[model samples]
Target chain A: EERPPPRGLTAPTVAAGAIAKKWLAEHFGVKIRGYMSQLGPIVIPFQSWDEVENNPFYAPNADVVPELEAYMDALRKDGDSIGARIEVIAENVPAGLGEPIYARIDAEIAYAMMGLNAVKGVEIGAGFESVSQRGSEHGDALTPDGFESNHAGGILGGISTGQNIEVSLAIKPTSSIRIKRPSINQAGEPVEVQTLGRHDPCVGIRATPIAESLLAIVIMDQLLRQRAQCGSDWLETKEQE
Target chain B: EERPPPRGLTAPTVAAGAIAKKWLAEHFGVKIRGYMSQLGPIVIPFQSWDEVENNPFYAPNADVVPELEAYMDALRKDGDSIGARIEVIAENVPAGLGEPIYARIDAEIAYAMMGLNAVKGVEIGAGFESVSQRGSEHGDALTPDGFESNHAGGILGGISTGQNIEVSLAIKPTSSIRIKRPSINQAGEPVEVQTLGRHDPCVGIRATPIAESLLAIVIMDQLLRQRAQCGSDWLETKEQE
Candidate 1:
């Protein structure tokens, strides 16, 4: 290839990590035994696998490094793997954050979450639980103050209704394992090799901040779009009133 | 009722006209007609018909003084009234203007055009005429310089391929005509009133520039989006190279 792969992914990953650190500092107000280890089998930037044989988590007695490593090692000992889930909640969102026709907020949010690695699916408030409820039960009733219920997730007609918007994602089990497994080589030949290395028992264990960053990207884009189209007029009218 | 009889229709007409004017100014270079006769028929701004009767185009010849008499007379005598059509052709558009997936450039352009008033349908370069063309004739062959033919209208994969983007819209016939027809009032009472006064013979005549404006909005939006996601990186990478 004439051009090398771009390093654009670095900026977002760094930004997400910074956000997570700030959240931890502000809310938890405590230092933990370990850091959020990004367990990775592959990096999308270069489309290459990272060797984890020398990783601290791979050490049999890596408890000296961090207790989380011990937890990850024990999970790796078993054939089973772990999975991660990331929840993103945004508060103080103004009403009307989306457009009608095709530019729906839910659709955009879903796309953002789905674009993440190992993320199987995403859901708004109540998720698929809404499907089991009756119309009266699920439909959020409006009041002078605001919605009496939040089953609607602060969105109606694809626009935000000046409430907290929330979303969650289900991450799939990490694929790497130490056990022997069937595989194919570059020549398209069937082969088998015993994998040896440390990996995240659940890849999603560290993806929370990544999900938050994705949500941030979606919200920022929507904010810009809404402001460009109708925000100025709405502000002017409100000022006149 | 405090509201006028034609409740639902009133707001949309004014809104559509205002949006149409803004769209024209931003996207196309054409200046809106300055004279009084050019106003869309429904721009009465109020429910009063007396105001409509006062318009030079609507007034009878009695008080139609010399200043506005000829214009009013032309409205009555012309078997078909005059309408305007605005055409917008984007020149020197760069290659690769749109993204894949639902945000395809052509679809966005079509959606924007359809949003405009009186725009029944839209067509791209050569439009339906291309259906009759053979593959060899219709296909824009590649060459060292670029495409040998402009039949594709400078779009491929919903992206601009460094060619002029051509679009046209068909405006429907104006509903308010001089001829009398069966109709129902807001009270569900049957009534017949001749659509007295001057109106465009064909609604599409003035639609060209409006269509251009819609196209421009879509193009500008897509350009900004493309810049944010892809072009910014491109610039950085080029500088590095």
Candidate 2:
């Protein structure tokens, strides 16, 4: 018998929403607030992916705290998924901390964001929208009053322009579902399984703070590297003899 | 007969200086600057050690554009050598780009320096000298205006503290000598051969710019990454509204 190629089928959003609502009422209502209150805003500290995979619980999602637990529970009961937006803001960055040829800043950032669990895509300040604007319109104009705007996202020549940088990520829906699916089991045997577990319908809810933590570690590593060379500019100051 | 390990012997500074001076006049002085200037500083961008073996010119001592005619003339003369000190300086850098962590900026800088060919050691912001200072004296105190002092070398917690980064290196004398020496050839046959080509008596003379170029790259990378995660902290109230 000939097998059909993979078909393009979208997940049933309404059905998923109803299931989510039931799951939230049955398991999440009481626990969500407690967990949220205990953790509040979360920050992942590990830089390497090995460290993160070794202990996923160490960096829990910030939105899962008490302040937002009720809403999350309600969301679960409604069978509708909610999205989380996190901003990893940093200050006091030094200039000249990136490689030119292959290890450019943009390349590293993109890799880091993609590494997050549910991050579908990343944008560095008005990213895709820039394509619609003219060069003069999109270019971050230099001005005596500082940059006219932040279209360049605080980077020039792949180096820090001493301005605040901004990035946003769009997370996708979680893959796990309670509904039955045709899938190959561990032995490559055909099997029918309905996933049953405590999980977010949208995994992106946990990705926000994790992105912030990785950025911190990368920045710290690069700063030390910069200081190792040419950190000094003035020496023989005319020896005021 | 079993050969005994060589005994440690100290040569007189005068003798060392004389040998160094003679070598500098005979070999390095002939065209060291010409080689370095043409190459435009010494940082080698390579993926791995295998790539390095594939390309010998990557070694700090290897010259890209050799003054062949002048070098041959010097090689024809009796044994001679030379040495030089190349200094690099980066000016107008902001403070507070690094943190004290597994990825300290100073440590990374040292690693880069050691990564270079024949580089013995690296130092940062009066490096080892700070070890002798008291806490009150060594610490960079913050003033309402700025810093009253900067003994910490513009760093704290492996992160930059918004100050000028400073670093230096000690370049070693080149190992290849014109005088005959015992060595094993590719066939594992022991033989004596005077190096026929002209090489830098000391490689440090061309190190300054290479170090600067790498430092620039690392700093720029970190700054951009930091901005992406944390630069949005300063978002205006209008956006919040």
TM-score of each candidate structure, all chains considered together: 0.39, 0.34
Kindly report the fnat of each predicted structure, to 2 decimals. Answer: 0.00, 0.00
Candidate 1 residue pairs that clash? A82-A201, A82-A202, B84-B205, B84-B206, B85-B205, B85-B206, B86-B208, B86-B209
The worst-scoring run of ten residues by lDDT in candidate 1 chain A lies at A43-52
Report the lDDT tens digits of candidate 1 across residue range B1-241. 1222222222444455456546434443323221112222322122332442344333222232343345335644643232222234566455676754446666566555544443333445544334233223444555444556765565654567767776644333344455454445666566654455545544443454345455555665665576687867763442243
* Model 1 ranges off by over 4 Å: A1-73, A186-188, A231-241, B1-241
Worst 10 residues of 2 chain A by lDDT: A30-39
Kindly give the stretch of ten consecutive residues in candidate 2 chain B with the minimal lDDT sum: B30-39
TM-score of chain B of each: 0.62, 0.57
In the order shown, the candidates' Cα RMSDs to the true structure are: 20.7, 27.6
